[model samples]
Target: MGWVNTHTRELFDGYYSLDITYELLLGGYYPTGINANSNYVARDLAALGLILSPQPPTDPLKVVWKTIWSAKVPGKVALNAWRIAANILPTRRNLSLKGYDGDTGCVLCSHDPEDSLHLFINCPYASDIWSKAGLQWSVNGAASMHECLLATLPRLNKEEVNKTLMLRWGIWKNRNSQVWEQKSKHASETFLITLGWYEDVKRSNASPVVRCRQGVKLVKPRAGQFKMNCDGAYIPSTRRGGVGCVSRNSEGEFLAGASRPHALLTSPFHAELLALKEGLRLAMTLQYTEITFESDCALLVQAFQQEDQDLSTMCLLIYKHASGES
Candidate 1:
């Protein structure tokens, strides 16, 4: 209490090679006054792996130093090191990063990316895949492509999030492969491949199928009233799915409603499970306390209680999510 902290650009030791004071003051991690004045050099001294082939490398540091110094490509290590330091970079992109000089419209839809949502979700090709997957997507007046992806994250769970991420990765990879490799496949095919990958992972685990317990804070219902309505639809064409739901007050007054389509395809049982997920998501969104989820698929409802669904595919995804074992 006798002396107060002061802001200065003094360094602690000579380990780290950057100005810690500037980062602490300007970075979002620290927003205080006195704490921002402190300066410290952060360094990792973890041991590195060694190679035993040919001549055993006595020191791992020497090997790493030699690799960095001997690289033919100039600035390669520096650029790659920067990327490693910033781990939050995206692994995929929804649109051609190459800005349109003449072609302002999306190649897939001929729509403007000014809103950014059109580049990824609102395009006709994207919409078709979504429809095949049984989702009805809408943009919330997004101004950038990143915003659209951010908006989608809050609506997805671990399973749904993984599927969404893989779909994006596959789509981006397909686009690049088509341009460079001169091989093109329809969006529908890519989506099917994504679904197959998800199924393969689940089946490899050999887990039983059941509805994973999802806790959602729902709105409380008034006396003698229902609070939510759930609906399920299955598309035989793509074996894709759509789930729609609405929340209502005790008087049956509408509060909010939503519909989502999935890009993966599977049996009717999986579609039914998707419907349940959609209903639960909607219920959570409206904070409904007493949710009355309804579905036309009876087999799916039974699968929710059964230990094993015996679905030809989608069993692992179902079990992984339902059991929360993963």
Candidate 2:
């Protein structure tokens, strides 16, 4: 069943229409993704058995719940996301459905019904808030608030996602205050709490390295520690790149150096990230623990220095080696 014979392909004209090429990194070995560190025959058999078993249908909304749960947001923020997505939020439309006598028109924008989608995404006041926050999203046609946020959540990095969650909850809080207290808050005042959440996430260990025109001079390590300096170089003409690593002791004496050229590099930023991975691998291989890594890539170094849940691709790759995953 896995193989499509030539006759089968010809009989089904719509089969295998795309042209594709692949370079195999492994050969002659079955890739049992759920196998243990030491491969076993039984594990492979079990994996195959599970794959062959009849599986129940999947729920698309479950994926949205997974994303919300995985984000490093506060518990209340996640609850708010769930309530809004499940269509249980006490917006004017929802309350009216529960026999509320209050007006269903949006308190902030009297022109539209205060449903979750309109109150949070499509209303003029909400649009103004989003624009003020430097986001331009108009989801008037979206079926729900969940659909509007889920569309963009995949593109945002971890930091952006956390901030977005906090910001949306803050906006809701502001909306509630305006509804009951009958006093409006300024745009800046409304999101002051959201800004605090962002500041708190970036407050610890977020020391950004200063870039200089002359070049950043390597700082020598303290006693009993080793310093690893790294830099990534790219040649646009050949579309190739290279990285260099140098280890120094407390006296600023070079102990070891390594450099390897890259092939078909996409960008200078990618080159820098690759260089960081190499430096980390080298340090771990050398069994060095008291080490301070220095890199010329400001964004990369700053990301490592930060103490938040950074699920960005760059941060994940750096931690992949540490976790001993191939």
Candidate 3:
């Protein structure tokens, strides 16, 4: 007598899988509690005992109403349950390929089915591009996408993993959009879009750091409060990066100071973002929730306030960490 209840509404109505109910009564998922008169499941089981079994009992709704009367759950808990159900529920399978008129081969590599694995890791174009990006993905020899991800986990840091997941989602979405909407974007275009996904996620934190020496107004902290200033330098040809940060009290006395060098060559904008990110992290560590943020880079400050229109790819991460999830 195995019982199943797919819909939650049915479960609340004192209706349960007969097998599951029996299992619960016999002490399974949770420990058996005292058979109190006010208890829902236990009380119901005591009432039904042998009176309702073998042939499915009618008035299942009556049992449900009795249970609800016995146990009143919080509305917020119910709301959370709904949210969890929506996120974890199994979705409709992809039957779009059966309707595809083009060759069964992949649109990007022209060698395999347009499955999740092929579009993300198995395609030749994707594999080579990932390799060039410094991730040593075994394009030809990998058996499955899961294997590829597992193998690459050690090589991919947190930032890289986030980027990889977003890029994979972007690639899969682009493939579907192109085929279904007839957008007809090139493989490189899809790849670039995938890269852009990282920037989108990080957009909130990418504001450039301003120099304290600049004309930008540095809001001094209130009495007994603290503040910090930070900036970054980037030289494209040298592939060198530098970050500087200084923390001070309301009296303008230095509390902390730090700077570091990075080997990778990057543009001035990237350098500014790096400095801001570092500064924000330091401020967060010091437990300052409402501290002044100033940057010599007008564009970066403006972007932080959403007073500017344009956003660069390099600063997306800085923006995300600073604003959204910080």
Best by lDDT: 2
TM-score of each: 0.33, 0.45, 0.36
The global Cα lDDT (0 to 1) of model 2 is 0.69
Instruction: Tell me the lDDT of model 3 at 112.
Output: 49
lDDT of 3 by residue, 1-326 (tens): 12222222244346555565555554443234433332234324544555455456575234322322232223332332232222321111123434545466665556645554565666666675566455556545665444444455445555655545544454556556666786655555555555654454455456866657645466688987777787888877888989888888898998886787867734676677777777877887888766776567765675666644333454454555556543
Q: List the residue pairs that clash in candidate 1.
A: 134-261, 135-260, 135-261, 212-322, 218-287, 218-288, 218-289, 219-287, 219-288, 219-289
Candidate 1 at residue 42, lDDT? Answer: 24
Q: For all candidates, what are the clash counts?
A: 10, 0, 16
User: Model 1, which residues run further than 4 Å from truth?
Assistant: 1-116, 205-326
Candidate 2 lDDT over residue span 218-305, tens digit each: 5668999998888899888988999888888899888887888889875676678777767777888888989988877877778777
Model 1: number of clashes? 10
lDDT of 1 by residue, 272-293 (tens): 6765676677776666667666
All candidates: CA RMSD (Å):
22.7, 25.1, 19.1
